[model samples]
Target: MPCDLEMGLDNNEDGNGSPETKKIGGVEEEDGDESVGLSRKMSEASICAAEDDEDEEGRKIELGPQCTLKEQLEKDKDDESLRRWKEQLLGSVDIAAVGETLEPEVKILSLAIRTPGRPDIVLQVPESGNPKGLWFTLKEGSRYSLIFTFQVSNNIVAGLKYANTVWKTGVKVDSSKEMLGTFSPQEEPYTHEMPEDTTPSGIFARGSYSARTKFVDDDDKCYLEINYTFDIRKDWQSS
Candidate 1:
């Protein structure tokens, strides 16, 4: 089957974490496998599966009561080692920044199309559906990747991941997810870049595709969800 096969991931050594789970091209394989990768194909066969009824709405699936950043720090102050570990997890976060809340809030600020040597096409993220209609147009058979800038607040977001399912003309094409390891709340936003990949080319590949993407934590708390559309064409759309 045609696919948007990823080459490899960046070293992501920014003290946050790196992507560990990559479900590429409508297939769920272990991370680092060579057969497939990120930027899964928008085809007509396999779409991402919802694990359970509750999982249908990933964000609403509760993992029970959780502690806030303030609560975590104040609870184990007497234990020196535990306190140090908490400090390490929080990194250099400002106490004034993270609010006193139960769940970590993640805001995906922007999504950019990164093509070699060209100016980035960045689309600012909204709460849900896109008001502008199409997100971007990628040149068929071009080598490009995607990057996301998001901020976390209140507490740590464990096992953060990116997952999206693609569709073309009501046919499910691909379903996949990538795991970006644990991240703590911080003042500056965190940036994650998917490995380079090439877009599929051919008469069939050039068309509009609709997709739904989610930024979710291990607890099934979805911070940001985007529902949008885009196109793959013989050439990039003119500005």
Candidate 2:
């Protein structure tokens, strides 16, 4: 099938939305194991699935209270992409940024998000101090991509040594629910993980990774900080 793929490049070490997800292209995969390895293809399929559902008014249909057709489509897309990326891209794809040194203009950071959309939401960073965070309303069950990238000081490694998308949910936006999805870039170079469940209004994620630090030969600056740029898009319907 033909599909549209989104690609993003983030210079920040912080896991924030800096790993921006943008549609890159359309790829048609031949049926077989080879198709599984092509993330660009899988993402295309995901996008198509998302585009398939919409009411005449352009709003997503709802089968249940607080549930929308858009959300369901995203849930399916996440599952399909995660499975395909793991089976196909893990060994062959190359994200060479994890091991190389970044330039002086770049920064390092990580990403975390909370659900429930109010004072009930929270964001956390496992590698650094947690800062006052921002909130984006994710339609229940919709698919959201967390594009993760890193920077280094030396060209030791080409890209990310490891990248993971993990989730923890709760009955009250606390750590009490099940982990919906987890993807690790261990088998290959380029891959995408299925996002965790966000349909319950209490599920969120942590996009975390490490990279080579850029430093001077002799300088007092010993710490690294990453910047996150959030790109939130809402169409006429989503609004």
Tens-digit per-residue lDDT, 1-239, candidate 1: 01232112222223433324433211244454432211111111112324331444465344435666676677747877657555665668776667476667788888887889879878887655453687778888788777888887776665577777678898877665656556677778888778777877788878988877777765666777777888888997887
List, residue by residue over 98-187, the lDDT tens digit for candidate 2. Answer: 222231121233333333343322223335532334323334333343422223222111112122221223111111111111122232
Which 10-residue window of candidate 1 scores lowest in summed lDDT?
37-46
Q: What are the RMSDs of all candidates, in order?
A: 9.9, 20.3
Candidate 2 has a TM-score of: 0.22
lDDT of 1: 0.61
